[model samples]
Target: MSDETMRWAPAVPAANHPGGALRRWASGWWSVVHLVLHPLALALHVTALVLLVTGTALVPVLGIGFLLLVPARLLVAAGAHLERYRLAAVLGVHVPASGPCPVTGAWWRQLVLDPRPWRRAGHLALVSTFGVIGAGVVLALAGTGLAALAAPAVSAGLGHAGEYSWPFGIPGTLHAPALLVAAAGVLLLALTPPVARAFTAVEVLTARALLGPGRGEREAVLRRRVETLTETRSRTVDSVEAERRRIERDLHDGPQQRLVSLAMQLGMAKRALDRGGPDAAREFLDAASSSASAAISDMRHVARGIHPPVLTDRGLDAAVSALAAASPVPVDVEVLLPAGGRPSPTAEAIAYFCVSEALTNTAKHARASRAVVQLWHEAAPGAGLLRLRVSDDGVGGAAPAGGSVADGGSGLRGLGDRLAAVDGWLHLDSPPGGPTVLEAAVPWTVGGDR
Candidate 1:
């Protein structure tokens, strides 16, 4: 499949809405309101957090002159997270609970030496800058409302500085100005959230600079890793299919053609003997029989190496049992899987080869009396994992030979490559003693037609 198709799969699943209670609950204006509010809450929380972080750095300067206020300074620094959480909830952001800031093992020494705390002190110095702006807007609205309500009362004292008016206060000569100021205050109050939101965005950007390892960057890195693994898996499957094609071509052209020619030659030899002496006939018959037997053995070996039919006809459970029955030593088979569902043809073949190679290694190297093969599907949190394990009661030491299994010692490298093609893994667990085990895990329904 193309990358676009793969990307679309998850979205289809996500778009499928759940039924019953969930559908009923989500089918209202409240849900829409909640959706809109959540982002606002997040912005508020992030902004407050930034302000708090900026304020924290100022503690050091104050501490230098008044070291006694260190405890109070620490409390003020911690209050940033607390206030962030509060704003998050009010805005409907799903914020997590937090305890004290994590302290490294050498926190006390680091606190004194690190530049971040000092930077935080600088941020803290600007705390009043934000506060003053926020407070100025709130107080301006309050003053205007008060002036509007008490317009008549403040008419005679219009030139006086301390006198204020409100819409519902005592009758005032300057009612018009007071009413206008109150109207302006009401408008400012209504506009505060959006203005605050924009300010918070700036604060979050600043906090990320001061706090280190911004959340967005962390999440982006994680996403990149997931994409890498997915693409790697896809490439691995493509390579495996390419290899199987190569092997099939090799067998069809080489051993298969040679066997057919040999059979034809034997047939011609028998016809010649029928026209000759009894002695000649017997010799030709014997030679032909021997040639036929050898060809049959060679063909069987090649066929088994390519793709064993037993694995396909009976699935992994029966195929493994047949393998154990064929082993030189007494072998056992234990299968623990669902009655059987067909995996992709490529996956099944790879699974069989993994088990066969493992057993072949054990029989050749490990001097064991008995062996066990187990097949099962491993159900994990998000994906279906199929596993096969081959164990032998033999000498444990088996490693890659001369760097390649083609040199004919242990088949580790070849087997590893084969497993990789089908998005599978082989793990060798052998300590230098009496028993060794090889485990294989293959992902199902990927690459080719499933």
Candidate 2:
């Protein structure tokens, strides 16, 4: 069998050697243990169900019994929790936990009205009731098989050769009948593992059906996700709009004014030249040239804010290195990304800006001497991720909700909004005293490899 299949499959047929047979049995031993423990689980489930039924019947007549529904529901939920753990530990079947029971108002209003508790009760009923049958058959078969296997030896050990015992009418000696019983015992032993595993699988399926989240809970989760996406998308749009307005404002204030001055200065220089005053025209030209250079520098700064030319030319590592070099505070930079391919352009931009903003925050607000910027790409649980970490040894206690000028919460909040644009995320961990760390990550794909 493939390794994946073998991981969950029951024991294979016994091998040639005793050791090999024992090893095979070891694989499915959990199944047998699970079956053996059914009585105890069945007791818990049955008690919960009894309370549920009794509470339901009594609540219609007297309100006093309505209180019993709370404990009943709690018991069933607890049993379901245990079932989840057991299934995961033994069968490796992970069932997602259902949402909690709604208890906003009266206990009867929530507990009796909600269908979730009923579903859990139904699962408990199915397992506890039908499970008894399977449990009985398995236990009986196992007990019978063990007795039959030992009958010949035990009978002979009694030192009676031909006297047949009354129990099951077996001959009390090592004869053909004894041999037949041993053969039957061997057949039942061979059948137990698969039988136990099959029962366990059925119980697991039932638990998943009723104990796991129901459709209402699933719809609630989807609704929550939609709400989150809506909020993030709105924030992303706002962030983009705010950025565009900032760029426009900066251009109007800086480069545009310089260029207007340049135009005025060149015009004066032309007028000076036309007046035949070479020295006056030469000074005007020099002032115009300086204005033009300043305008170019301002434009470059705005362009870097938009998307740095360095980031476009070099990869994320080199781009972040430039940021580190420019930061007022000393920054230790390290980038460990793939050489063959890189994250998508959007991801790289996010990383670059993340580093830039973090460094900016460190320099402006952190009041620290040193900081560190590290970026890397690695495989995550479900996909690949490009992660960035920026840490500073600064006075900590950064606020999460933004709008705190003292702690740079506003900038970090903007960082979060920016990351949410690409379904990325940012986490700021800054306690009191010192050492604040900002960790952010964005999912990436290998197809973007360089």
Candidate 3:
């Protein structure tokens, strides 16, 4: 059998077996209870809908009618919500709730524009028809079953000879007639559960069709998600290209030039040695060595910017602390990573770079006397998120868009794009005064051991 079929397969033996059949029959009877109650519940919904329709119609004539719109919409939504739950609990079918209506603009306009209310109204109208029919069928079956079951007592009370006719012309008299009637009653009772379940299945199908967000809504949601992802991807690519250019420029201006100078100095030192001037040779050699050392230092700084070793060795907590200590402004650092809970290396790297970039902006642009860095891991049920907050008491009005790195916009924008690459985000709250606060968060999965 397929996985789905196997999942729903009964644990008990086949229904042909006596005990299994009895169990099945018992379950069927239990389902009858829900069917009996269904119509009464539907009746209340129908009455409420009738009143709502009347009130809505009177809206232009009476201002009071406008006041009823909100409550009426809510009442309809409530009925649909209850029906969804009822279908799940009683019929073993789940129908998801509709997406929320737009709450902006006038309430009446919102109600009129929303498709859910009208959909629910139509559903209730159909349900009312179904309920009336279902109620009549159930009452007929139940009344016939009871009459058959008590035929002897009922006939005796009415002063008639006990007689029963079942299956067309098959007639019985006296005690035999009573037994036959009672058997018919037992059969009807046994059939009730399956009958009720069949009716409930139809109702659930109706509810699923009308009460949930339809296909158009789902498509719109998907389209919005696609657009958002596309924009993010574009920004990420731009940020990466900018970063690569910055790296190339840094290498050419700093380490690459130092290495070239060191080579020139080595060539000069070789010539001095050939000319047999020991002091001159030694001076050239020292200068060359100093140049080489400077080049190495510059390369190390570049490599650190790419991925800091401190972040890998000591986790985000220690890394952020080090960053704060090195800041031009006195920075207060608070790190709250769980003892054994550290984020994945990629996540940690992204977070570290984000903070590093933010601090760079704060120090260079924000002429702040003090700053604060807060880093912590928030553990939720199924996942954890790493949160970083950087605030500076500086000349504010900082934003993630507009201006260059020198003026402090590209850096923040780059940080945002970088965070986006790792499913992280950056939020900057800097009004045109002082105290700029930059907050960032990224999904974190606990790394093994460290």
In order, candidate lDDTs are: 0.57, 0.80, 0.76
Error of 1 at 191 (Å): 32
Residue ranges of candidate 1 with Cα displaced over 4 Å: 1-271, 274-283, 400-410, 421-423
Candidate 2 pairs with clashing backbones: 340-450, 341-449, 341-450
Candidate 1 per-residue C-alpha lDDT over 1-450 given as tens digits, one digit per residue, 9 for 90 to 100: 764465355533423655643443333223223223333334433454444454445546654423423443454345444334433544333323322333456754445454444434443333335534544554454455454445444554566344444437744335465556557655654444444444444544454454443345457667976876676567556556766786788677666766776677677777777777666667656766776677677678777777787886777777878888888878788877765355666767777777787778777888888888887878753346678888888887663322223333334555665566555667777767746777777776544433
How many backbone clashes does every candidate have? 24, 3, 1
TM-score for each prediction? Answer: 0.48, 0.58, 0.59
**lDDT tens digits by residue: candidate 3, 249-327:** 9899999999999999999999999897877799999999999999999998888877888887877888888888888
Q: What residue runs in model 3 are displaced by over 4 Å at the alpha carbon?
A: 1-68, 75-113, 117-214, 277-279, 379-384, 400-408, 421-423, 445-450
Question: Which candidate number has the best TM-score?
Answer: 3
Ranking by lDDT: 2, 3, 1
Worst 10 residues of 2 by lDDT: 399-408
- For model 2, residues 254-365, the per-residue Cα lDDT tens digits are 9999999999999999999989788879999999999999999999999999999888777788899999999999999988887655677788888888888888878887
Q: Return the TM-score for candidate 1, rounded to 2 decimals.
A: 0.48
